[model samples]
Target: MGKLKKIETEIEGVYIIEPTIFGDERGFFFESYNKRDFQEIGILDEFVQDNHSKSRKGVLRGLHFQTEHSQGKLIRVIKGGVLDIAVDLRKDSATFGKSIKVELTEENRRMLYIPKNFAHGFLTITEEAECLYKCNDYYYPEYESGIIWNDSELNIDWELKKYNLKKEDLIFSEKDKRHQSFKEYKKAGGER
Candidate 1:
């Protein structure tokens, strides 16, 4: 098994993982994931799929989760960096409605774990960013759902200045731009 250090986030199920990297002037190497090592740190979920995406700075992609195949993601950046965000939505939990943000970059090699039932998203901070993540369940398009990234109630700081980005500079897909607000998502019982 690999050596991985787990750092707990403020939220109950989320975690920040620091993988042991071996490097020199020749470059570096590290095991991104090892099933046995992950379990030793309490990440028991079995990952069923791997996803990758590339985006430029100012691109904002989500606050989304699936109702049917809700995914718990282990996210990392392979090239460049981003501002990763996750919002707690499990109604019965004490930290419900809370959110956490972590700055992930290729140079840092840190990873964030977003348990199922939470909304997940990221804003690209570098000129270009490539993200890779593992999901615990298969995605079902019919179950795609999200909360608008700027919902006032969530109070996410976003930390746009890290990349000299302004509110007007962020880009979004048409669907992300039209997502439901926090109140609307809750009113529709999406939390349940």
Candidate 2:
């Protein structure tokens, strides 16, 4: 349990998890997500699904969530790195419409826990990146929906140029490109 440190983000339920690493001439080792360590921080929900994804530089994959069965995700990068992002959507919360971003890399071995009711997404920062995550709920595409990534109202400040990538350099699915705006989400009554 002592091997993990959980740091709260400005957003109420988001957390940055750092694990103590033991390294030597050979390599390094650490418990990526120990149940005991997680329990110590009051994250008691059991993860029901594990997901993995690989993306090339300039690939951006979300701002998505399930409207009916929202998922809480614990995300980490293994092969390279990414700018992981989460946006709060709880209408009654102070941080609603706010966001938090973190750089998750192989070297840092850090992870982000994004609770339900937030949009989750990431941009691959290296030539390629491999991401793994545990989810508290299984995916249900029928209930899937998203807020558009570059909504003016959210003012996400993705800092795309800092990574030497421009908006045109990014790759997005037509579905993601057409996601609703934050304003639309609000008009629709937010989070079914």
Candidate 3:
């Protein structure tokens, strides 16, 4: 058995994964992903896609989801740090609308698993950051949707000042700047 521990968060279907590292003068070694170990922890989905992204400090990426091809993701940071956020959007789930945040850094070597049907996003907390993620599904631009990062109703703490940043300091893709509000999304009939 690999040295992996899966920690459940307050939100159902979300998990924090820790792997035992062996280090010496040679450096450190650990299995980043083991199918058997992951399956043992009840994460059964087969991830088909891997994505890597590098963002500069004060870059806020998402709160994005897909109405049709929703994706479940297992994510970790390979360089620098980020405050990753996941929001439950399963209408029937008891924890619907609740969100959880996890700090991922290269030093910690931690991963966050967010099941399908959740909105996911993150803010770069250092000068620069690189993130790697595995997704159970492929991307489809036509079905992509997102909630505004600062949606008042969702009430996520982006920690601008804590990172020595103001909202204006954050950089975003033009598309992300036009995402709908959480309240408006629901009112328009969710998962449409």
Candidate 4:
């Protein structure tokens, strides 16, 4: 689809996609994803799993990825908005241990494509937001791993206070809160 525009980030393989929108009195229309067009832009991986989640404001879902079955994700917001993030975990990569953040909102209609060997996460910025993503690999619970969202080593600039929320206001699952730090992830051999 000529409707798609791919924006490259500082990190290699990660991209922000802007789909051309046609608006009128009847509202708007845009192609979310077209395999051929996506392949044209280097997003040639085939998506095997589709996942959706809903969360309230101040809720943070991850900094998560699989070790043995690493996934490349194409993520977007279907309702409300979120601050989506991807952290490079490939030890051999020039940008390893670095992260990129982007805002995905229903209004902006932006999407993010995170390559495999990266940890992914997001924070809900609206009262409630629905996030949808396509994964190139299947989910394998046994291979799951994550880095603590607040790891000092990564020091992600979540800007939670800018959204009028304190760190105390953030809701996290027990698993997320207890995840290993980036240092620990590296110490463990950093397998992608």
Record all residue pairs in model 4 with backbone atoms less than 3 Å apart, i.e. clashing.
none
**lDDT of model number 2:** 0.91
lDDT for each residue of candidate 2 in 1-192, tens digit (9 for 90 to 100): 247888988999899999889889999888888888899888887999999999999999888989988899999999999999999988788999999999999889999999998999999999999999999999998899998989999888778989999999999989999999888899888742
Encode model 1's per-residue lDDT on 45-122: one tens digit a residue: 999999999999999999888877789999999999999999998989899999999999999999999999999999
Every candidate's lDDT: 0.93, 0.91, 0.93, 0.92
In model 2, residue pairs whose N, Cα or C atoms come closer than 3 Å (at least 3 residues apart or on different chains), thus clashing, are none
Which residue pairs collide, candidate 1?
A: none
Candidate 1 displacement at residue 92 in angstroms: 0.8
Model 1, C-alpha of 91: deviation from truth (Å) = 0.7
Task: Show where candidate 2 strays beyond 4 Å.
Answer: none
TM-scores of the candidates are 0.97, 0.97, 0.97, 0.97
Per-residue error (Å), model 2, residue 89: 0.8
Q: Can you give the lDDT of residue 147 in candidate 2? A: 88
Name the runs in model 4 displaced over 4 angstroms. Answer: none
Predictions: Cα RMSD each: 1.3, 1.2, 1.0, 1.2
Candidate order by lDDT, decreasing, is 3, 1, 4, 2
